[model samples]
Target: MKKTFQYVDYLWDEAKAAELGDDQVALFLYRSNILGADLRITNYGGGNTSCKTIEKDPLTNEEVEVMWVKGSGGDIGTLTRKGIAGLYTERLRNLKNVYGGLEDEDRMVGLFNHCIYDLDSKAPSIDTPLHGLLPFKHIDHLHPDALIAVAAAKDSEQVTKEIWGDTMGWVPWQRPGFDLGLQLEKCLNENPGIRGIVLGSHGLFTWGDTSYECYVNSLEVIEMASEYIEKKIKENGEVFGGQKIEALPAEERKEKAAELMPLLRGLASSENQMIGHFTDSDTVLQYINSNDLERLAPMGTSCPDHFLRTKIQPLILTLDPSDEVIDTEATLKKLEPSFEQYREEYLQYYENHKHANSPAMRDPNPVIIIYPGVGMFSFAKNKQTTRVASEFYVNAINVMRGAEAISEYTSLPRQEAFDIEYWLLEEAKLQRMPAEKPLSRKVAIVTGAAGGIGKAIADKLVAEGANVVLTDISQENLEEALATYKRDEAAIALCDVTKEESIEKAYKEANLAFGGVDIVVHSAGLAISKSLPDTTLKDWELLQNVLVKGQFLMAQKGVEIMRKQGLGGDIVNIASKNGLVSGPNNVGYGTAKAAQQHMTRLLAAELGGDHIRVNTVNPDGVIVGSKIWEGDWAEGRAKAHGIKVEDLPAHYAKRNLLNEIILPEDIANGVFACVGILEKSTGNTINVDGGMANAFVR
Candidate 1:
């Protein structure tokens, strides 16, 4: 079902109690709607918006209303009192002008002091001052389908100019929030009185004195562009119907699928497109199943936003729209040049619009959907962007329904879209977070850390400046893990990971050790020793209890602590190597690992909406006289292989191409990477397998 999007008037009604003079409240409400729209209009939080307001002290007769902007995670549709905070506009503007920019912490404190309600909430939006600099009262930001359709096309700027005239000013896509806002401020100062802003390869933004005015401006810009594209499409929709044919058998189908995937993958710079994010979706099945495949082939991708999503075009299954034959090889050959031309044009566009010293180029196979007979498929960097682009294409198709409509839709020019897609300023936005001074003060809980990978991860995390709580099922092993770390830097807790009561107590103890728990890594898991044929129900249940059930309980408790602290947190799950790429000999262990991996992904998707990052790591092998791999079991396994127990680690390491034995430290580093202590890779997984497997399964 389509999610509802609110208008500026709806926001106006919500803030009626605040009165016009309560501009701070008004500003907060407005900012909330912008965030809401960003969330509702797309999948995930693909877009963001903000507002600025002044704050005053009722007492002292002194005041600086400043700019009360939306706090991070403050969704527009449901923004509340604490979601918006006060920021000093003059301070921000001054900082931007300084030789070196102000730190995120200082800027956060500047805004934090201005919050009217809770001080515990995250700092104001990174784009606080960017909104402050806008001359308009209301701003509307979105990755509009109509606009993206034009933005990523071959002559998008020309199309944009023809459609909007001098009324709109276009900016290359920059990472949104602060950096985009700063760049926008620069643009506004240069352009003077431009009515709206078009971010090539990104989205559209329009503003006015009121929400209605801004909304109308946004609609007008999109409507004009859509109308122009519609006219151009009418001139060439049915130029060719092409030729037609018949269907193939099941074995032939699988063979054809294998053949087409490689070609499509070859079109991509990496193995990403063929094994892209959408291979598992129903849409992929539908595209591949379509009988009249070539009917959709000649048309361009739905829109520019889709370039990163559905790709430049879907792979046509046959030469004629009515053909039922799934001639995958023939279809790929016919579509080859269009793909090559698309890449060339994309690069040229980037070069034309970019400065000499810009960041390196991104891949050019923006979108590559597959069609098996009549079925279709698509993918993108994130789930949300992919959905929006897909829907936009469907919408554009419907708009031209039955009107001699074939290839009516056009994407923004490749060069213009390329410029926006590869814009360095935008890339920088991904790294532009408010300085996390308080994050350093936060504490984390890593479960199952009695030894092995858990202990290694905890040590690495502490060294980078975070108080850590190491927990395990064994009291002696827990103490052993504690001994490996500095007493002042870490604490140890004993708890059976399989029990909720034990996890709850561990959370309480960890919370008491530090002021609050800000990060949780559930690494304790049991691996079944038997093969699937030898595995019993009890063994399966035990693995599920320790790996799957324990993770759930720990995550539940971790969220409660994070929520109470009013500061979001991170949760990392240590899944096994079998989870992502295989159905190994241990049935129970493999099943549990797979479930845990997916659970981590689902958690990240849900919790990310709350500004919390949820992710997982899949460690291949790290056996070093550890409890899980020690004693009789290790010795017996070693004897079976005709090697001493002490030689097992070396033997396993030699099996991998890198011949690098993965230490618990490597696993620990993977966890930190997920927590973004290293970089911002959320809802992802890293395999510490030393190059064991390189297939694209997940």
Candidate 2:
């Protein structure tokens, strides 16, 4: 029978390949990029490609064989020439004569530097020897789901023989170092015509005399394995034991995920604050809702790259997404103990596998969390890292599915997982990473952020390493505002603060995008100027709804997400000096500002136990770049003060104690202080009014 799914295809473009002519490095990069473009062939940063090129040596001025391989931390899909490390092939081959055997692998890494042919090439990865030792002109090492299925299966060796016979080879699990390189060379010598080798419970290696041949050989093997697995899956007739629990409705699953992510983020951040990413795609939903999920999930992932980023295992939450009775409070209470237990088990695993000189146990928290009928959440120090972890785990799930369809799936043994996780090489990599920014893992939401003070606040927060969700009532403004930022640094959510549904939806957007909120700024407000006689019930209600009620709704929803995250948070309310000083023709706007100020104090006192600080920034006049001063409000204030609308800026500046102008940027600076600097203070007011005697907090 014909299959419903597709298989990997040959993407080698002859026209484009011919354009490069005989540039071996360009051809090497081309083959690697096409292989990586389709994730079904290999995961991002999971595979490497290399080629032997004849280049003139600077010292000898003679053509010599040099190997260019993908270096440490380079993703093949995005690989450039700069990402390739070039080394003398003769030097690498010579190291075998002075080989120190299995115990001396770590020392070999430093020795590769002496083999460098160029001073500006990238830092070579540990896999350098695997490519250097082989005599082939071109080589590719990929973690394709299809080949890894054969590699991870219980009968992995037998499957390798069944799929390709003597044409491909097999070797049991070995750490990637000098010894493993020797084993691959040994495999090739024994099987002279072999075109590839399968690393048991690891990945695949294929090579050819030229780059095009290498590209086709890799694709051919992956396509063959994919067809073999698809055939067996058809014969077996069921997957994951036929899915015991049906998935929740897509929207309901999204809603449940929004509820759970914040709580999970809080639990995962016990050691260090973490950012989060969530996904409910069909791939994850299929596994988590399966009858075999309980049995298979504990088997964990079989590949090293998968587990290194996702951890040795993932945590499965008890609350099913399809549960009819959703008692949110009870669900929250029950999650605490589960997270605690997962942490305990992680510590126990570390203890069970530690070497005498193993690096200290790392954050004993789960990087990936799953729930039946819903989806998975992955957390890390930043959004991109969190997203990558999630992607790696999904790759792991596919590897398990392919392995299980034909034969039982097996994870790397505990000791092997530990060895790779705590290797001295990995410790050095971490030490080389640059120090993190102060707000590295923080997520913030700024209301009315499309313009004026809110826009400035959002800009400042992003500059300081915070991921911000910019929300405003106008969709046009919201889209325009977020255009200035990278997708990972900022996002837009359409919000109307006066409407509860709008506020709830926006908060949920924040939860799904960047984990949870650590800082909340309510800068969405409107202003009006009216004398006691002219201020009608309609004008008072309008001002109250926008200034007072808007701030209240934002705080109410923000505190809910912040509390779920369990980390302390800051809430900065953009109030004004009109609240503290009595002024003519300001009856409606002044009273509303007063209410917003008091609400800040009340919430600060109430949420103190939760460590959620509430503060206020009162700017006397921010008319220069303010959206509030654009229309009727500017005219009303100018008419009452006996000044032209254009002169209001000078008028306000001269009246202040400092006789200096205050702009929206000044208001934003005050907000940064409340959230970033004034960590010890709450329920306090910082006046950005350039000094007004009556408006002083004291």
* TM-score of each model, paired residue for residue: 0.40, 0.92
Model 2 stretches with alpha carbons more than 4 Å out: 1-5, 9-22, 208-213, 322-329, 530-536, 620-625, 637-665, 689-694
lDDT of 1: 0.58
For each predicted model, how many residue pairs clash, with residues at least 3 apart or on different chains? 48, 0
Q: What tens-digit string does per-residue lDDT give for candidate 1 at 357-439?
A: 66776666645454444323333332233444555445333322312232333444545555445545445654574453323
**Candidate 2 lDDT:** 0.89
Predictions in order: lDDT: 0.58, 0.89
Q: Please report how far candidate 1 places residue 464 from its true position, in Å.
A: 21
Worst 10 residues of 2 by lDDT: 1-10
**Deviation (Å) of 568 in candidate 2:** 1.8
Question: Considering every candidate listed, which one attains the maximal TM-score?
Answer: 2
